[model samples]
Target: MSRVFVKKASYDNLDQLIAEIFTLYDINLRGKRVLIKPNMLGAFPPEHGNCTDPRLVAAVVREVRKQTDRIWVGDNPMRVQAGGGVDDSARISGIYEASQGYYVNVGAKARVISIGSEIIAQMPVSEYFLEADAIINLPKAKTHMIAGITCCVKNMFGAVVGSAKAKIHYDAGHAKRFTQFLVDLYKYFKPTLNIVEALTIMEGDGPTHGKIREGGKIIAGTSGVEVDAVVASMMGFQLNRLKFLQLASQAGLGECDLGKIEVVGDFEPWPNFELPSTYSGRPMDNIQVAQAAEIHEVWGQVGRLHPRFIEENCTACGSCAEICPAGAIALDPYPVVDEAKCVSCFCCAEVCPEAALVMPKEEAQTLFLRLNPQIREG
Candidate 1:
C-alpha cells in the first residue's frame, strides 16, 4: 500500500510545513537531481488560485536545496508568448529569495527530446522529463469541468513542450481516448512524489474558471493516483468518475481506491465543502436507463453547450489548446474548436482564466442528449 501524508497548515509560516512534508514522505534531497514541477497553469497571480502558489514552491525548494544544490523547477504554461515565455523565471526567483535558495527553469535550460513515435508529427517529447532523477510534482487541487478533477496526473501534461501538445489533442478528440493519452504520458514520466496544494481549491467551471474554496490542506504521497483519489474523496465524489484516475489505475500506474491506501497525519474528513451549482448540475442518476432519462432531460436543458467566446475578455492564450486532449483546438487567429473533433470535454472552457469562453445552454442540452442517447426519446 502507498503512504500519503496529509497535514493541516496555515500560510503564516511555510518553513515548518515544508519540514513536516519532507519527513513524512521520507524524501532525501541531498545530492539528488530534483525537478520540481509547479502548477503554473498560466501567468496568473497567487491570489487567483489558478496556479500553484510560488510561496509554497519556494518552501519546497529551500528544503530540497539543503539536501542538494541541484534544484530545477519549471512547467509548460498553457499559452506562453515569446517575451512572457513558459519559464516565468522571475516568479521562481522571487520564491527562492524568500526561502534563501535560488532556482532555474529546467525545461527552458534542458534540451527537448522525443518520447515515443508521434501519432501526428515527428519529434514528440518525453526524454527531457525522463532525464530527471527525482521529480516533485506540485499540483493545485481544483474541480475540473470535465475529467472531474485536475490534480497530480493532469499536471503532467505540461511536460510535453511547444506546439507538440496542441497537435496531440487534435489527434485524440474524445474524452476516453484523450484519457488514454494521459495514461501514456504518466507511464513515460513517473514522478518520485506528488504534493497537492488544496489550501485553496477552485470549483464550478474549473481547473480554471471557478470560485476558490479554503480547503486549507496539503497531501503528499509517492503514488500520484493515491493522492488524487484522496482529493476526490474529500470532494464527496467517487474515484470512478475521474477518467484520468481510472485510466491511471487501469494502466497499473497507481491506486485510486482509498480503502487500500494508508494515510498519515490529519486523516479527518474535509470540512464538507460543496461544489458550486454551475459545476454540480448533474448529480441525479438512476439504476434504470429509462428512469435515468428523466434526470438527463432536466440536466440537459440546464446544462446547454456551444463554445462561446467573449472577444473582449479573451487573451487568446490558447490554454484551450493545451487542455484539449483530443487536439480539437488550434490557435489560429483566435481559438477555434473543430466540432467534429470536440468531445464536449470543456477542458478548453474550464482552463480559460478571463472567463472568455462559455458553453451555450441550448448546445449543452443537445450534448447532454447525445451523451445520454436513450434520454432523447420523446
Candidate 2:
C-alpha cells in the first residue's frame, strides 16, 4: 500500500518537519543530481497562495543539501515561452532567493518527445527533468479551474516547457480531454517525491485567481497520485470526480483508493472547504450530465473566454505575442489581438507576467452563450 504522511506545519518552522519527512520517505540523493521542482505558477507572491511558499522550498533545499550538493531548483512558470526566462516569476514569488543560489532557468532548454497521447502526439519537455537523477515535486494545495484540484499529480505539468502547454490545451479542446492529457504526461515524468504546501491554500477559481484559505498542513508521499488522493480527500472532494486522479489510478500509476492506501499522522477533511466553481457533485459516469456540467461550468464558459488587455498594465514585453500559438496577438506598441485568428485558448493571458491580459467572467459567459445558443446558461 502506498503511504501518505500529513503533518501540521507552518512556514516559520518547516526545517524539522521537512527533515523528518525526508527520513520517513528514505529520499536518498547522495552523489546524485537532484532537481527541486516547485509550483511557480506566475508572479504571484507567497501571501497570495498562488505558488509554493518560499520558506517551505528553503527548508527542502536545506534537507537536500545534507544529501547532495549537486542540486538544482527550477520550474517553468505559466508566463514562460520557448527561449524565455522564468527568473521574473521566480524572483517575484521569492523562490529565487529561497532556492539559495541553486535556481536554474529550466525553461531555457527542452527536448521534444512523442508522448503518444490521443490529444497530443509529441511535446517539448524541459531538459532539467531528463537530467535529474531525482525530482522532488513541491506543489501548492489549490483548486484548479479546469482540473478540480491542483496538487501533487497536476503539478508535474511544468515538465512541458513553454508555449507547448497552451498548444496542449488548445489541442485537447475540452476539460475531460485536457485532464486525460495531464494523466498521460504524468505517467511519463513521475517525480521521486511529492510534497504539498498546504499552509495557505487557494479556493474557488484557482491555479491562478482565487481566494486564499488557511490549511496549516504539509503532506508528503512518494507517489504523486497517492499524495493527490490524500489531498483531494482532505480538501473534501470525492476523488472520482477529479478526472486526472481517476485516469491516473486506472492507468496503474498509483493507488487512488483511500482504503488501500495507508495514511500517517493526524488527518481530517477540512470543514466546508470551498471547491472550484467548475466542480460538480454529481457522479461522473453520466456522460450527458458530465458534458452539460463541463459546458455550463468549465469548458464552455472558461474555454471561450478571450483575453482582455489592460493597457495601463501592458509593458509591451511581447510575451503574450511571443507565446500565442495562433499568432493572434501582436505588439502594436501596446499589443493588440486579432480576434479572428485567436482560438480562445487563453495562452496569451497565461503567459502575460504583467497581468495585462485578463478574462472577464461576464464577457466570457456572454460570448460562450452567443456562440452556442443551444446550451443555456445555468
Candidate 3:
C-alpha cells in the first residue's frame, strides 16, 4: 500500500515538521545525492501563491542536508536571459538562507545528458538531477490553465529546460497528450519522494493565474502517482479526469487508487471553489483570424482578454513584457499586447499585482464554452 503524510506547521516549526514527514516515509539521506525540484515557474513571490513555497523547499532541503552530504535544489524557470541563462537561483537561495542551508543553481551546474526518444526525442536534463541518488519533488498544489492541474508530475516539466517546454506545448495540443508526456517524463526519471505544498492552494485559472486558497497542510509520499492523485482529489477533481494520473496508471508507473493507498496524519477536506472552465470560445485556427478581429471577437463578442490598464495599480514595472512567452506584450506606452501574438497563457496577468490585467466574465465563460462546450450548461 502507498503511504502519504499530511501535516500542518508554520515555518518556525518547519524543521521538526519536515523531519516527521521524512520519518513517516522512512527516507534515508545519508551519503545520498538529493535533488529538490520546486515550482519556480517565475520569480513571483510566495504570497502570490503562484510558485512553490520557499519555506517548504527550505525545510525539506535543510532536513535532507542534515543527513546527506550532497544537496542541489532548483527549477528551470520559463523565462531565460539571452545566451541561455536561467537565473532564479538567487530567489531559491533566499529560501535556503532561512533554513541555513546552501542553495545552488542546477541550471549553471547542469550537464546535458541524453533523454532518449520516448518523450520529446533527445533533450538535456540537469546533471545534478541525473546524477542524484535521491530526487524529492516539491510541487505547489494549484489549478493550471493548460493541463488542468500542476502537481508533482507536472512540476518535473521544468527539468526539460529552455524552448523544449514551449515546443512540447505546441506538439501536444490536447490535454491528454500533454498528460501522456508528463507520464513519459516520470517513467524516464523517477523521483525518490513526492512532496506537495497544499497549504496555500490556488483556485480558478492557475499554475499562475488564480486566487490563493489556503488549506493549511502538507503532503508527502514516495509514489508520485499516489501523491498527485491525493492532491487532485483535495482540489475536488477525480483521479481519472486528471489525464496525467490516468496516463501514469496506464503506464504502470504508480498506483492512482486512493482507496488502496494508506493515509497518515490529518486528511482534512477543503471547501469547493470555482475554477475557470477551459477557455474554448475561440477557434484554434488563430492563423485565420487577424489580431484585431480576434481581439474584437474574443473581447467584443466572445470576450476573452479584456485587457485593462489600472494606472493606480499599474507599476509600469515591465513584468508583463518579460513574462509574455509570445512577445505579445511590449512595454513602451504602458504595455501594449498584440492580441494576435497572445496565447492567452495569462502569465502577465498572474505576475501583475497592480490588477492592471483583467479578463471579463462573459469573455471567460464564452471562451471556456467554445473550448469545452461539452461541459454541460447547468
Which candidate has the highest lDDT of all? 2
lDDT of 2: 0.78
- Cα TM-score per model: 0.79, 0.82, 0.78
lDDT for position 97 in model 2: 98
* Count of backbone clashes, every candidate in sequence: 10, 0, 9
For each candidate, the alpha-carbon lDDT, in order, equals 0.65, 0.78, 0.65
What is the C-alpha lDDT profile of model 2 across 174-194, one tens digit per residue? Answer: 666788888988887788899
Ranking by TM-score: 2, 1, 3
For model 3, what is the alpha-carbon lDDT of residue 206? 70
Q: Who is ahead in TM-score, 1 or 2?
A: 2
Clashing pairs in 1: 30-67, 169-326, 169-327, 170-327, 173-326, 304-361, 304-364, 304-365, 305-363, 305-364
Candidate 3 local distance difference test against the native: 0.65
User: Where does candidate 2 stray beyond 4 Å?
Assistant: 82-84, 280-378
Candidate 2 has its poorest 10 consecutive residues by lDDT at 283-292
Model 3 misplaced stretches (Cα beyond 4 Å): 82-89, 99-101, 109-114, 117-119, 279-361, 367-378
